[model samples]
Target: MFRRFALAGFAAALLFLSTTPVVAAGLDAASINDAAAPPTRLPDRQQLSPSIARLEILLDRAHFSPGEIDGKFGENAQKALAAFAEANGLSFDKAVTADLWTRLVAASEGAAVVTYTIVDADVKGPFLNKVPVKMESMKDLPALNYTSPREALAEKFHMSEALLQALNPGQKFDKPGDSIAVANVLDTEKPAPVARIEVDKTRQTLRTFDAAGKLIAFYPATVGSTEKPTPSGTLKVTAINKNPTYHYNPKYKFKGVKSKRPFTIKPGPNNPVGVVWINLSGEGYGIHGTGNPGKISKAESHGCVRLTNWDALRVAAGVAKGTPVAFVESSR
Candidate 1:
């Protein structure tokens, strides 16, 4: 299922919004025709199509992450908008009506993407030569860090390594102080302090809402599995740790570990938990980032909600202490 939501009117809305571009976030203020204003002269579906990339960026700006922006109007984009609509209390009325268009333009306030010069710090890595696949091997590493400059750069931009490569096109990200194109993404305009988090296992998504009950941001998530199911009911957020160390306890007896002694994996971007850990009241269960963003929700988690590192950071930045978290089988 694309989602648990009824798809009855979605086809019409998507068909028109799949092949054109809307006003970009980066266009000159005058040319953009009141980007800060309610949308006027609303764009046709074709115009909305090419805006997929921009839409993805804007949704991301507002913290409704569309995962990796592929510049294609597909499931992720549709889901993103649906999430946005649901958060803002808009009706999915079989089309991208003026209200929705206006809201989107208002949210997406800057250039869809822009150029970034790679800095010394960005390329400077005591980078790992390779990342091991198993916890046993990973425990022995000096740091659970990214294996290369390109990988770091991609994660920094909340992009897929592959997509980043395609954008650069034969340009090696190996050098510091080099210029590269990056999503002129939204700044750290964190949403109003998060009041709660909802993890919809059926759709494999995580959403954050404010005290006003407005959706602040949402992201694709890999919740726990049939074999290692997540805790049911509500859990409170207990703590949040950034660049967390991975502790492999022999007690858990995960498949590949030969050692009975406990060991810790040093912190880095590739750490099993990615960069941030949003610990929940459910013991050993929380929402955290993953080394494999490309596989999010495509795979089951070991009883936690897994988001991309950047997405996790985005989530972490907005939430505060003791927020309520609910794990539910959502109808949508």
Candidate 2:
């Protein structure tokens, strides 16, 4: 019976994302318009689509704190669910599924999940214009290899992917032969401060909090390895460097090749450290960007908290000298 329910749930999710012809192929204006046209009233907890409800339950079990699980897909619920999905090698899309629920349950039971929260609103942009741009031709655009075209745009604009998606939700990127609208890009306003960081060692999660204890954002992180346990204590952001030239010292015990070349990689997403570096006042410890976001919170770092390049940049921008950071073992 459980298996049958799971399979049925998965099929329903497919209909939600694929069969919904009105939904666009990428983050585009049409999609956004459709999504914004009439806010579909979310079902009650008992009436929620099985997959979504299962996802909520699993997230709650994993300690993701998906607000009130009345089964309504609210902003808080979506954010929490996305964070959990991202941690488990799933896309951040708010859609839920049986597989996702199963994996989440397994992680909770077996101790494999992690969570992070945004404590501050630091690095602002690439700001997104309320209005989307009309792409005359995607024929000239690059292949859609990554997650969303907006994500690709974020790369082009040198801004956080999360910010791009947040500004333009449910938009489609493909317009076939017609021109598709793209949102106007804006400059980052000002850097703000992150208030708190909640690190769950058991679930291998890290969360950030604001002074008011509100969750601004969240991300998965790679902590220290068993050989080199991550240092515990309250750390503070001492400095932030953008497009930093990494100083690879052979003595530092890095996993990759030891180069005498002092390999100074340029900034951008492909950089070894991604784009931003939050230097912590706690000596050699700091939170920095990573070339591999998919492996975040799942892999081990040298000792510092490792986050996705986009996430790290935002965190760095929000943080400053004396931003307090705490690392704790996760109960979930």
Root-mean-square deviation of every model: 9.2, 14.6
Candidate 1: stretches off by over 4 Å: 1-51, 88-102, 253-260
In candidate 2, stretches whose alpha carbon ends up further than 4 angstroms from where it belongs are: 1-79, 82-192, 260-262
TM-score of each: 0.79, 0.49
lDDT by residue for model 2 (9-42), tens? 0011111333222211332222322222112344
What is the TM-score (0 to 1) of candidate 1?
Answer: 0.79
Ten-residue region with minimum lDDT total, candidate 2: 1-10
For candidate 1, the lDDT comes to 0.69
- The whole-model lDDT of each prediction reads 0.69, 0.48
**Winner by lDDT:** 1
Residues forming the 10-long window of minimal summed lDDT in candidate 1: 1-10
Q: Cα lDDT for residue 252, model 1?
A: 60
